[model samples]
Target: MKRLHLICLLLAVCCQEITAQYRVAVIGSSTAGGTGAWPLDSAWVRRFNYHYKHQLGIVDSTYTLAVGGYPVYKGMPGSYVPPPDRDGPDHNNNVTKANAVLASLPVPANAIVFVNYPSNKYEQYSIAEIMFCLQTIYDSVLKAGHRCYIITTQPRTGGPFDDPAVKRKLAVIKDSTIQRFGVANTINFYDGLYNPADSSILAKYNSGDGIHYNNAGHRELFERVLAKNVFATPLPVKLTKFIGNYSNASIALQWTAECTDPNTSFTLQRSTDGRNFENITVLKAKGLRSSLYEFTDRQPSPGKNFYRLRISETASLVMSNVILVKNPQEGLQVKGLYPNPVNQPDLEAELLSAQTYSGIVTVLNTAGMSFYRKETNFEKGLNKLIVPVQFLPHGQFILCIRYGDGNSILRTFSK
Candidate 1:
């Protein structure tokens, strides 16, 4: 009873530690002001606030300080500029407005300012000018010991930015700035909202004018931001690949990782349904610059086997994409290989055997050159095996498996 009470107390403390409270200030233009988004609450900023409070379990207060025709920089006289101070009344310069907003925050140190540059208007600001204004705001925020997240401009249908060349230039600036700040510090709203086919606003999410977003657009924007900011777990290890193959009545999980730190490790997870996963094993890190990791589940489910990898770090765990492996159907042939085109050094193949047999596996190019040959012992049921084809050139190839019983089969694959 005493131990149980202590465990509960520890769990409570951990939960409290993970739940961080924040004050997010959305500073931008009409889009940030919930313009064109029906019912107001469906706006991206509001949806993000809701998600923060519910999905992330974070107690965050959001405030929008956006106005129509608001540009990040102080444009030239003819350009769209904010009202200037008329001697008695202070001219609301972009920087001044931001400063006022930041000053009003009760806890600036714990605040994260979301600054969206409203450049998709009648006149587009030069990248240099925009960066200068952004740098100014960022410096001010840092001086106040607060963090700032900048949102790049979204696509527009008919604005000056609609020109492909102009849009590309603006994107270059946004991309460079985000790279400077690191992926975690900026919200990539452009990537979230831009239509790849024509570089216009996605039809379903647009409010017809291309400058504003509909409710669904706003929700999608919120979801994308959440994927990078709240839901994502950043890790030091770069995961190159996480895949699986089925054979020998089990599933083999393979992964390639570039471990920057020697202490990095991984936990392999298995799921039958792909939705619910269970940690199958913890593999020790190779602790090298580049390493290959593999784990085999000797008893996978009969049908589809889903696998993922979780890199264990000092502070958090980073998960990989799920890969599926399935037992081959009853046959005397190779079932399948994951990532068929093959990006890694090896490919895993699932083979079904009618009886216990010995076989020779060979991989040949279209030119008939046998680049790889290996002998394997197959069990009566399902057998999983690895065929090294990293040395083969990138193109089409054929895998031939010759059994001692004189039965041979060939399957085509691409490198």
Candidate 2:
């Protein structure tokens, strides 16, 4: 049997060697510090340490740098006061504290840092402001060449001094942005605790005060983190082929993998526009051996169809490369714009249509905000449209074509 040389295809895949020791760091405030949870060992952080060891077989060294009552953002004048202990060398500056905490570790590389901070008290800071602080700390850790994870603010009870509206708003703000940083890099504590209907922390999980967790609460958090299995050392699964092709008004995807884990499954997902995706189906592994898998979409949407797979095992989620299938048989199809690195304000897009249609062209920034929008008509067959972008400032932008037939194509270009 020919063994698939899968390692070469993976980009810097990290495998645990016999001599390698992986470190896990927990950086947050009292919430992550195990505050209100008796005998700190029962704190979620400590529970995570146990799971990392037995579940992942990692020589995990766990460290916590949580200052009780610390705010993730710097204190604003006349709004909130810094914790008394903030005067220490770390200064309670989230970025400074994170850097110091990480630097103090004996082994920094190959380390995963989980940052959790409660936003209950910081009513003055908007979600965007808090996100900026979290991003700063995240960047600092990344600059040091380590993987960093951020936790969304958990549900809390509004207190007399604490404004209920602000706490809820901040929690939501944190939840939305942290996940966007990286889907795999975030530990979603908010979802595990917040009541979906009321947007409050579930009563059972909430410590009577509504800000912290009880034993059961901590345990629930521990379970969610364990479910992610991010700490698990990856087992190499080589993929020799991953291809998507259009045929007979359908799109078919096929891939071959060599893996020894029997408890593996592949979730095939499809997307019309590249950004949002929907699961098509799931394929389970035949056994702890090599296998070939295939899926066909009988009725794919017109225009560009994107396909990707999420591979799951006992402890990891691996993403496959995205493949595109272009079908210009029924709906409007827009091809790439020329001279993408445009030096001038004039840009052109190539459009292909099977029927007459009209649609809008929108240009968005990195923030997903539309700065330029215009409606245009497409004739049956091929058509070229010239767009004027000279009014836009210098930066990157996404061009999207939304047709009347509920078909759209998106492409990113710079000017």
lDDT of 2 by residue, 45-107 (tens): 888776566556574467677777777654222223444743222445354554555564446
Q: Clashing residue pairs in candidate 1, if any?
A: 84-91, 85-90, 85-91, 247-383, 247-384, 248-382, 248-383, 248-384
lDDT of 2 at 118: 67
State each model's C-alpha RMSD to the native. 16.8, 14.5
- Total clashes in model 2, counting residue pairs 3 or more apart in sequence or in different chains: 2
Tens digits of per-residue lDDT for model 1, 1-415: 9999999999998876676556666667788888879899898888877766665555446767776667664311212343353111123534344455556444566666777765643244556656766676677667766777777667666656667787667558767778767777787666536664456777888898877889887876675565455434356788887777777787777888987667777878776556446678998888767788888788775456678776655444456777888765433667777668888888888887765555789999899998988877777788888887878888999988887335678888897
TM-scores for all predictions: 0.48, 0.49
Span of 10 residues, lowest total lDDT, candidate 2: 74-83
Query: Positional deviation of 104 in candidate 1, in angstroms?
Result: 7.9
Query: In candidate 1, where is summed lDDT lowest over 10 consecutive residues?
Result: 82-91
lDDT of each: 0.68, 0.70
Kindly report which residue stretches of model 2 are placed more than 4 angstroms away from their true locations once superposed.
1-17, 36-39, 54-57, 74-89, 92-109, 160-164, 235-415
Clashing pairs in 2: 6-238, 157-210
